[model samples]
Target chain A: MVAKELVLKAELRKKLGSKHSAKVRQSGKIPAVVYGHGQEPEMLSLDEHDFVEGLHHGHRLFDVQFEGKTEKLLVKDIQYDHLGKKIIHTDLIRVDLTERVEVEAPLIFKGTPAGSHEGGLLEEHLDHLEIECTVTEIPEAIDVSVKHLGIGDSIHARDIKLPDGIKLITDPDALLISCRLPAVTAAAPAEEAAEEGEEPTSPEVITERKPKEGEEESEK
Target chain B: MALMPKRVKYRKSQRGKMRGNATRTNYVAFGEFGLQSLETKWVTGRQIEAGRVAASHFLERVGRVYIRIFPHKSITKKPLETRMGKGKAEVEQWVACVRPGTVMFEIGGVAENVAKRALARVAHKMPVKCRFVSRRHTIG
Candidate 1:
């Protein structure tokens, strides 16, 4: 459980101006959108470093404190930049603590399986499953033990253990994890055969080039 | 897209007999109960009265609740109430009253997903669409 803290922000709502947001971004603060639950989405800016830290510790649930008030927000979506270095945008859902909320939780594999040691490939049919659960009781990750999984065994969504307040929103029979024989390719051996057929009788020629002096590019 | 194509059928015959076994409510407490009102809109008591009446009917069958409604904002050129005037189907906005605990949201003769339908039905006869919540989507 995480406690809510107020984020004192000076950037109040103002009329649109010429690339004012771009100018604000230059100041190192990132803008974010928060909405859902019958509320008008609002634009809120946060300190870049602080915002990243809050998201990094996203376990069950956290609050987004803006202005002088704090609201319980479930991290609905997070966007990333091209280089995947910066968090571009974040979507927050106002959650009712007791009311059941639908969330897609990650599936985590635990305990090495007998199939894994035998070189069987592990494949996951789904990355996440939607579950209807109380916000407070949301699991960090649903775990499935692969210790006894055979080469052809699979784990389904419904098989995952859920908390009392949680309901599996995914199809009951949908596959969650699968153990399978490793994929074998014929291309490598065929390439070796082709190389034997087309043997290079003579030594191959090689070439190297060196730039002349005074060809270096200048940097500003 | 995450939704599977397979139908999650809730057969009526099974539910009928199953209801007897579910005589005892199996719902756990939903934390310390509380309510937070987002907004409210005033409507003419004439046609919109049925929505409240129907909602209250289900509420009595269930328990205490909270309700909220706001004007539906539009960003499109074509408006919905062009053929008929605003009085026909006001469709002001979506309204909801969450019980928080075990909300068995059911509607119509059949127990189809009545959450969205229940809201739409409110404005059909009246100018209101009310949501009825119990414990779960499908009751025993």
Candidate 2:
């Protein structure tokens, strides 16, 4: 589903350079661009603080307080200072609430693991997932319970709960949680280990070779 | 007829100086930290981990925020010269670019601590090596 879009207000496109972009930054306006829906990529600017605030609260959507009434939008593309760095330029897609939109909702785990008390190690796998639904249907987050889930327990993508009219857009069998076996140390005596193993193995020896008629007495 | 001010008008304060470069010392002053809400939906064919799901929930429930990760060298033992990775650029303008290799970011508005935790998770889970830099921090 598509996310609800926000209307944007920006002035001027900035070129990538120190002197030019610096002049833009100096005015408390950060360099940005707004382009979508057959519109030519327009150069624009936003308040550095407001843009950063939007990135925090409304990562995908935010109300742009432009003109008079605030407009809503989805975060389309963001270029950071570098890889995994601060945001530089952000792309936004305008949305209409009446329309169905596609967006990614993050996955959330609910409750403490019952297996934690039992010393079973639990692992979380996927975090964010994508979906297509009405903007109004957009869920803040999805909650999956981990109560009483023990060792070897598993949950796949299909198991995550979805609100009515909302649908799953990820693979169903993708591994979500898994219980891992603890590692064993080699400091224990080999003899004690072999002694414990010998008893369980004794029955197997008797089953494998029924005594030959002549050797039966000797075997006995 | 002349265009009517083009709607939006922005002006800078009058006490501005020249455009010449100065002999600089490295420093940056970051703004208040903030958090944002992040979320995801379950798809049919995907694998969803409980911890990640939980982390996402925690983020959405708590919201995302910004915590400045500057003065990147202060916390670590390595010097900036010894550790600069790849092609990093410094802006000739803007006060934020005081440090040559320092990187800044607005953590997607989750709790500052929570955002750090989530990114830490990603770093460990990633197939390749990744590191994040932070110097000063305080929540308001």
Candidate 3:
């Protein structure tokens, strides 16, 4: 389902560059740039607390109001600080509601694969898929049920059932998830040794040996 | 200074391509954020030690820091003015080959601001450029 739209009040930023951005961040605001669909880029500042709260709610698309004008935008990218903790900058792209746009939608697995209980590990290879859909029909995430999956079973992008009007942009053959046996452990060799009633041998160590004087003389 | 192997079976190894996750430990399964490398380089033991020290010092022992890379490959250096025909020089130092997208460090058990600040110090000690990645962010 499409997430609820969040409306945020922002102010047009007159200053540009890193120095100004640093100053803006110091004043409890975040610096952002918005552009797309042939429109000129606009510099803006948002309340730090409000933007962070919206992020906590997984709100990617926003209605940004600045100078009595509001524009619908999708967050294209966000730059975080060196610790991946605080948001340092943001890139917002203007999105038309009626037009279909390609974006990555996260995949949400609904159920545990049946093989998981029998020592089979469920591995999810693709966490998101590129899809095309109208802005109004954009889904927050794509849910895939793995409850029926058994050992050696796999799910590909083509196997997904998209909602009406939504098209998959990623390769249909791309593997999304799979169930496989667990990796072999180091104890396998010891088990084999025990079955034969012999002591387990240590692994061979490869190394270079010093040339003996007699061998050197023989070569000469 | 850092820990060094007392002895190694081989002084040098053949140039091997890091093809398809050769290392068994590939992912940062623990920690909230990871320091992922953007380029391939030889990260020496001293560099890793320095980074660990810097991070631990900054965090003041409140947060846990995980060093994901280990300098296992022995690097040898010849003595000055030595003849070219001599055998391989003794192992001088150890290094860890960091490929693109390798998580070299992981930080957790602390507030976001504290972890970021502590990791920033660690980044300054690294050879290659790195970015902070959250555990929630899926790597492509």
Candidate 4:
């Protein structure tokens, strides 16, 4: 189900650039831009606390109250700091309540796979999948149950049961998760060396050893 | 043994600079929790191995630990008593040049608290500062 609609108060930003953005963040607001429908992108600032709270609560659609008008906006992208800790910037796009759009939906694998209990390693190859759905039908996340998976069993994108009105856009053959036996540990290195037809020795040593005189005489 | 390229085009490489944040493979992709680098540095092969051991030991073989970075760049060193070398030093070790925002290690098939503690043990073995990151939440 789509998240609850959140209304955030915003103001038009006049000063632009890294300097201004730093100041905006210092003032407890996130620098953002809104653009869509071939309209000029407008710079704006949003309350950081409110924006972060909305995100934590899984709210993607927001009604931005700006200059005596409200605009329906969808979060298109968010740029985090170098440490991936703080939000540095955000991109919002205009959208209607009924408009259909494509967006990435995070896939949550629920329940431990039965294969795992059988000594199989559970690996998730994809964390999210591309999906197309109406603005109001966007879900917080797609839940996939792995409880029934057994050894050598896997789930592909096509196997997922998406929510009503939601269509999967990712490659149908893409592997999302799998349960497999753990790799053999012992003798793996030796087997690899035998495959390569090389003596078991460190590859870092580049110097060649000279043959001993006794060995040369014996060969002769 | 720690991960190293079976063969490299060059035996030794210069200490290149790490600039800006990682542009690719920066998010938690393959696992539920990840250890993200907060600074740029050359993570040595030994360090990678140590971190892996640390995390795996902490998890007690209950989960899988994935090493995202490989030590492909070979670093060289000169003898301690040697004066100015006539040529570059010999190959000593290998390292992976990690930039900020890079997810160097990931832990999966574990509980949130377990994953956090496991990755914390890994961070203790890493040279760069690290933080725990989860899969980013998004909606269509």
TM-score for candidate 1, residues paired by index:
0.49
Tell me the tens digit of each residue's lDDT in model 2 across A80-178: 442223555667665666767766676666665676556555565555566778756776566778775776787788877787887777787888665
DockQ, computed on Cα atoms, for candidate 1? 0.01
TM-score of each: 0.49, 0.47, 0.61, 0.84
Best by DockQ: 4
Candidate 1: segments with Cα more than 4 A from true spot: A1-24, A189-193, A196-220, B1-140
lDDT digits (tens) for residues B67-117 of candidate 3: 888887877788999888777776677788887667898885455687778
Pairs in steric clash, model 4: none
Candidate 4, position A26, lDDT = 98
Judged by TM-score relative to the true structure, which candidate is superior, 1 or 2? 1
lDDT of 2 at A156: 86
Best by lDDT: 4
Sort all candidates by DockQ, best to worst: 4, 3, 2, 1
- Candidate 2 TM-score to native: 0.47
Worst 10 contiguous positions by lDDT, candidate 2 chain B: B39-48
lDDT of 1 by residue, A60-133 (tens): 35555667787776667765442224565556677777767887776656776678666665565565778888
The CA lDDT at A92 in model 4 is 95
DockQ score of each predicted structure, in the order shown: 0.01, 0.02, 0.08, 0.35
Model 2 CAPRI rating: incorrect
lDDT string, candidate 1, B51-129, tens digits: 5345434433222222232211211122655765433332222222222121122221112243344434444543223
Q: Enumerate residue pairs that collide in model 3.
A: none
